[model samples]
Target chain A: MIIMVAIDPSYLITQVLNGLVWGLVLALIAMGLALIYGLLDIVNFAHGAFYAFGAYVAWQTLLSGGNYWVALLTVPLAMILLGLFVESTLLRRLYGQDTKFTLIFNFGLMLVIVQTCRFIWGARGKPISIPSELAFSVNLGILSYPAYRLFVIALTSAIAIAVFVFLRKTHVGMATRAGIQNREMVQVLGVNIGRIYTLIYTIGICIAGIAGLVASPLFGVYPEMGAEVLIPAFVVVVVGGMGSFHGSILAGILVGQVATLPIIWEPRIAQVMIYIFMAIVLLARPAGLFGELGR
Target chain B: MLEVRDIHTFYGDSHILFGVSLEIKEQEVVALLGRNGVGKTTTLRSIMGLTPPKKGTVLMNGEDITHEPIHRRAKIGIGYVPEDRGIFPGLTVHENLTIAADGVGAPGGNYEDAFKFFPELGKYLPSRAGRLSGGEQQMLAVARALVGTKHVLILDEPTQGLAPKVVDRITHAIKGISKKTSILMVEQNTDLALRLADRVYIMRDGNIVFSGVPQQVRDNEEVQSYLVIS
Candidate 1:
């Protein structure tokens, strides 16, 4: 028996746009992971949990009669405060310890965060309606695309650019890059590297929080929502280069296409294809596309 | 300006410095000379609090800083150029100097003073530090220290792997810097150390074996016995 299916060109365009949107969201999460890893040398397995927490918080805000704009404005600030607390209380003690210690700690922390969400919000997924401003679709030459997804792409791109400028142009940002390269030297040069560490960790967490809040309207808020994206986001980071900021952006978009394009063919194999692509890339370049060897 | 009094330091339980002591007065250039593995680098690390001494005090301008963190020690006017020069290879030369200056709240015009010592660095401001030649990197390291240092600068083997011509340039820069800030340096090149230092301390087995003026070091038999050079 032969199966014949007709594929629409507009559907392909829609899938590509969807891929871009998802990729940008992944880039935000991956950048946070990269920043924390670059400076602190921690993999931060709890990053996904932080994402879930942000979504839940946004959901809570909206349910409490606050608007989507309010959630967007306040969620990152809340994440920053939470990040400060977590870094000082838990991660600080593991600074000089082995990397595996942080891995295990973050893994456990992820479990705690997920369970906390379950206790407070229950186990069902919470839906967030699209904001009225972005509720409509924009007509492209080939297809009509969701305005919210396009907005996500634009906002994320702007954020990525801002982060790049901050790292390259500002004093604290220069120190952060230097610290990522050589933490000891930055300290010896009279920078309070500890403060840089706290700041970086908090900023990273805040970014993850923003990504979570932004994604919630589409993906819905749930205890396990973060875990669903965590692996793919990690793949983005690894493929981009562990600590390279620009690399994450490129890899995120690539992985997003790899994730979404395959759905047009076989949806069941889409997730497996990501890992296979990662394996091939790792085989070709052990350091990933942009990472320095032995970094 | 700086005093290390009988400090004991270890590297994860393997003791590297045992009761080592040294002093640097205002605007004086003091060199610590010793054979390899005799704890010269360890002495510098101890003073910088990279490896905080377990038993003694590190005093800066009469204030004890034995337990102060590395950055705090640097903030209190301790500029350290480690054995490997400690240049952030990924950063640009301009960025390297800027970070050092900002760390200590040095004036914006400090870059010009640093450029005065090594004018070649001015041309390489936008280049990555790792791309610089060894001599340029050493110059950048010293220049970086000069930009932020208020009271004293600490150097560990600044000319370890440089060419002779480069060594002469560094020596000239050191002489120029000495007029501005106190320096505590470790050197294997006894002749160069003696030429640039106002005072010299010789170490053997993590302890100060001999210390005196350059003339006394040349004339003394005991100091010669400790050092490889006669």
Candidate 2:
């Protein structure tokens, strides 16, 4: 059965809005990935699993009659704790070792976490009802859209701005940024490089966690949902320069547009469009759009 | 005061320093001179705990600190200005100095004094360090290490690649800084080393072949043969 696609103004506006929200969500995940890679020099294959884990934590909190706002705050914090545990238990050992060691270790971690979530939450998808305050539609002169979608976009933008300020204005943030450039130099300057590594890893995954928590109501919570976003996040990181914060956000939005814009003309082709776009961009820039050579 | 006694260091099983030992007294400027690949840098690395010595004692103010990590050594008042200068090119000059100011060392120090030492750094505070001239970058590196009130400053090839005028400027800065804290330096420019160093130790093949006052080192033929004259 053919599902008819419409190209009306309202439809186009709605798609663009949806794409923006999804792009920002992807940006959130990719930013963490980029930060981790930049500082810790780890690809963090288990990031998506951590994302799913956060959603599950949010689901658990909400299911226990906790407020939506509380779950939103608590979920990322829970993810940070989980991140700390994961770092100290596993990733810490892999630091300063061969890159392949972390790659294989995190790959194994992804499987373990995915399987653990399946065992706990079951294989079926779980739905989280949108908060009542955000259930209404928002009208913006030219378009009417779900208020929740607007909230997601606003929240992500705020987070991005906050991160920018933290990295630029604060002393700890400066040390972290310095560590990204030269870990040994930072260490010799009396900055605890080991602690910085743990903090960055935790912060990275917590951002992923927040992305999962926010996306759960829209996308549904499922064990394999993380697997879906994880691959796209990889694409986003590649399309963006590895370790560039600006590059990840731009690439995420670009991927988001490429993924959805084509759906108006041909629904079937939209799925592969992102990959094709990535390939084309990579062919032109090689290291990615903003990727530094040899980074 | 700082002391490294019979320290042995390795780079992945290839021993780079064998039983290397040295001493710096209070407010003394000591220079380590050697030909290329003779473990001058390795000695600094061992003292900094960047490459922990396999066997030996490192003493800071008469306390054993051989097992301390790099940051701990810094916290205990050892400031290292590395061979490459170790400037974060992506960060601005102000950011570079700010990071070191945020670091732990002698208390009650800030970026103002650093800028004062290298007045040229004030103009480039907003510019990325990578864009700075080599002399400007070296100034920034040294200024970064000196941002805090450190007890001991270890400089590895502080004037490795700089113009004569810039080298003279750095030499003047070192003279000013040496009055505040003890310095252990590794220099290729023997003339500059002799000028700044109260005493000199010459290393040959990871071992100290000569240790004497600057005038004594200037008079010795054996140590002169191992030195890199500039």
Candidate 3:
């Protein structure tokens, strides 16, 4: 019994690392949702479509005999340009309207995007091999960790840092924050709020794209790739609270812990654990842990 | 050097400003006076093209600007500071000021003149607009409106919630502008507005009820009790 329980925590610790990696993936997707829904008050349901692009682009790069690192860099830039295109053309049209329109319409757009992906890539999962260099696990005294997973952790942490810094220290970030408070007031102050809105949308979607690209090597790419990451991202966004960056991070990790660590006990119900926490969090705080009260 | 002629504007389906019109020349300060919900703000919005006037023309120096966009109007020396004290709360005081001037057509920007009016803004240049006190934000709103190049400055309300002492400072600042620019201000404080205005127009229910020199409109207690307050 002691041996079974002893392997339990080690198994759990390993799962904890898995959960961190998973949470980072969700956090990237959440960054986009947080920017558009949290800050702009526009629920960009089409975000998963962007995530789909990140996975497929990375998939194409791998199939084309290209380096994974080049694919990593190129995919995000492609997503940024894609974000810019969607913003300047379609998203700009929907802004300031009742948000019910965005929710329903973007869902429709999401359907179109998914169908497009299905048409192109077919309805099958494709496994991606880790770059040969990252296949080894690093053994710390207490735990043995996969180096590729560690790379994922490091990359996600770095992206999270960069995101926090951008939102806290940059001009566009400040404008997004103010625009979130009162859009009309910001516009009247002589700032081109239209331009600011576009930038936020681009940045938000690109983050999701990066999340997709990074996850491709680990989970591989599939037509339903968005479905795998999106549910957790929504939960992360909610558990993280609307527009609260740090809240998203903490909540993401916590949700991740509940999902992966608990899976060691009952594999069938591992994913269900996240919903349980989200339900509890909603009942108790509604804003999730670290969520602001008055927002 | 501003002329608003027979402008019509709407809010949804409601016709707010029907043929609203006003004129103010260079170095002159005009007051747009009215009671609540009578479309005073709409008239100003019409001029700035915020609510795109349905029919009418706005001329700055005899040029038709009936369909020109707000920024285009801004480019042609028309600066607007809305009634709401629209401060971009996410920006630092400096960022707020910078965006107003960067890539904007501010000819001979009297940056020094702006500093003279509200030097308090210079101190909190790095602070976000949300962090500043209300009065400082007001100063920032005004400073942004005037920092760039414009010959005509239209302010909806510069002293709405400010203390009397702050109002005095704002009024004094308005009085100090040189002859190169014109000022059009709207205020609820009839006494304070008349004191600063060279010309005043009392608007009632979408039309000009009274228009004259400030002295002529002063102590017109009958107009005050009925139009100004009621």
* Highest-scoring model, DockQ: 1
Candidate 3: share of reference interface contacts reproduced: 0.20
Instruction: Give the CAPRI class of candidate 3.
Output: acceptable
Error at B187, model 1, angstroms: 1.8
Chain A (alone) TM-scores for all candidate structures = 0.96, 0.95, 0.93
Task: Pull out the clashing pairs in model 3.
Answer: B106-B149
Using DockQ as the yardstick, the better of models 1 and 2 is 1
DockQ, all candidates in order? 0.75, 0.71, 0.27
Per-residue lDDT of candidate 3, residues B1-230 (tens digit): 78999888888888888788899898999999888888888888888777878888888899988786455665577777887677767567776675566425332323555687788778898788889877777788787877667788888888999888888888877787535679988888878888888888888778887888877776577667545454
Model 1 lDDT tens row, A1-295: 1221367889988998899989999999999999999999999899999999999889889988998999988798789999999999999999988789999999999999999999999999999988999999999987898899898899889888989998988888999999988888888888888898999899889888899998998989999988988899999999988998888999999998998988988999987988998999899988887888877
For model 3, chain A alone compared with the true chain A gives a TM-score of 0.93
Q: Model 2 clash pairs?
A: none
Residue-wise lDDT of candidate 3 within A156-244, one digit each (tens)?
89988998887766656665666666665455444567787788888888888888888887887787778767788889889988876
Q: Give per-residue CA lDDT, model 2, range A1-295, as digits (tens).
A: 1433434778888888888898999999999999899888999899999899989988889878896788888998898898999999878988888899999999999999999988987999999888888999988878889999999999988888788788887777788889878888998888888888888889888999899989999999999988899999989999998887778989998998888878887899999999999999999999887788875
Error of 1 at A175 (Å): 0.8
**Model 1: iRMSD?**
0.9
Model 3 stretches astray by more than 4 angstroms? A1-9, A38-41, A96-98, A168-174, A244-250, A264-273, A279-295, B62-75, B103-113, B178-180, B219-222, B225-230
